[model samples]
Target: MSLHMTGAGALEDPICTYPGSRLPVRAPCARLEGRYLAFLGGSETFGRFVATPFPALLDRRLGQTCVNLGSINAGLDAVLGDAGAMRIAAAAALTVVQLPDAQNLTNGFYRVHPRRNDRFLAACAPLTELYPEVDFTEFHFTRHLLIALHRHCPGRFATLRTELQRIWVTRMHRLLRGLGGRGLLLWLHDGDDSPRSDAPLGSEPLLVSRTMVDRVLRQARGLVEVPVTAAGQLEGETRKMDFGPLQRPTAEHMLGPAMHARIADRLGDAIATLQ
Candidate 1:
């Protein structure tokens, strides 16, 4: 499939597809070449709107080939299940795994699309049995379905949130194990990690807390998290970003140059220990 990684430019980006990976990655991946770094995550990792995403910034900073293995709205299932993506990540000198929303993963409660984790597929018998009054077919995206469910019945949604958190923790461990010694877990969010009971836990990264992320690291200090500043949120130019009219709103919400720079700095510092 032809993936649009950039807008029409005077100098077109060399983004292309390589064997084994479903999503188009920043080209010249150098999968078989010298010491390289692998960055895996959702659209933010892909540098959706910013001229330089964190991986690209890190590549220039470290003077290494940092392969962009970003998948749109991706979760553990897509990366872990794909042999080619895992192959490149495992082979890399270091791999940075971005923590996606807790709601995107496939769990006992509900199943997301295999390739598009954001797409809500079908609720399992248990979820349906839990909310027989709700029509699962009424939703397409995971967030939408979850919001409606939460509003309709907060009591039942709590159970689902707990399950998602439990699954996220377990699956994260499994993902780290698969990536081996080079893998570093990254949590890139827009705000603080302070826990709030009323925060929509079923939304993007719904119930995940600082403690949970710390649990994944286990005091290893391998995790690199960067919360964007309020000013940084407004930093972006349409000229640097790529998207259609329908997607303009979403592209606006992506990380801008300032945030990318911050993330890259933290990533550079964190990856130094890996070397």
Candidate 2:
């Protein structure tokens, strides 16, 4: 659902990077100050098409300085590689981490772009050998590559899925431990509030299962699961989102302003318990 294409540059959010991290985050950058909250994730956490993302809304809701360290298409490597962002998370009162898709990360089967985790840089020997028919060059994004691979060979795709889930768990554990147990896992599910099915190549946060989440929960302070139903997502898609004509399709799949407000409300309550 993430299209990394840009429009006429007519609509852009203020963004900047920290001294030690090259990740582009929402701007009016946060200083390494005292008692601030750090929010980390991909596009949703970055407020891709929304004017005021939940992080900024939380700032007003809680009367605290909330730093938005979100980057579009960011995965485990992107987050872990950004020393500046990690440092901010370490020093924050609490770090809210949105669970990113397992497929976007680099593992034994493939390697993704260092900064743009969504871009498919190259497929490793194992992956190439698994799907010897597919031309790796045909793919530009990880999601596209994964979908094609699954459609080409569902059986073989299972192996890659298992590896991705495992790697995601390990990386998530590393991130949580780095936060000194001050991390809160935010599970942003885009379709039902009930338990997520293990169907391969499913919705966003692709290939990640509830079991994988449970494996990494011990290292986190808690988990906040927010489900945005399909109908709910389409409620005011065009009306509430901010995007140019070229970005319309991508923005439609994104959470709207109403959902962001709901996320802020839920996170505010969770954050209050910690304070």
Q: What's the TM-score of each model vs. the native?
A: 0.86, 0.92
* Model 1 bad stretches (over 4 Å): 1-15, 195-199, 202-204, 219-221, 229-232, 235-239
Residue runs of model 2 more than 4 Å from their true location after superposition: 1-10, 191-199, 229-233
lDDT by residue for model 1 over 114-210, one digit each (tens)? Answer: 8678899989999999999998988899888877888889888889888888888888887777677667888777575664556565223556787
lDDT of 2 by residue, 1-275 (tens): 22333557446656789897899987768666778999999988988778788999999989889999998878889989888789888999899999988888989999998777999999999998999898998899998898788788888988998898889999999999999999999999965423233444776678777888898998998999888643234656568666777766678777788788889999999989988
**Which candidate's TM-score is highest?**
2
TM-score of 2: 0.92
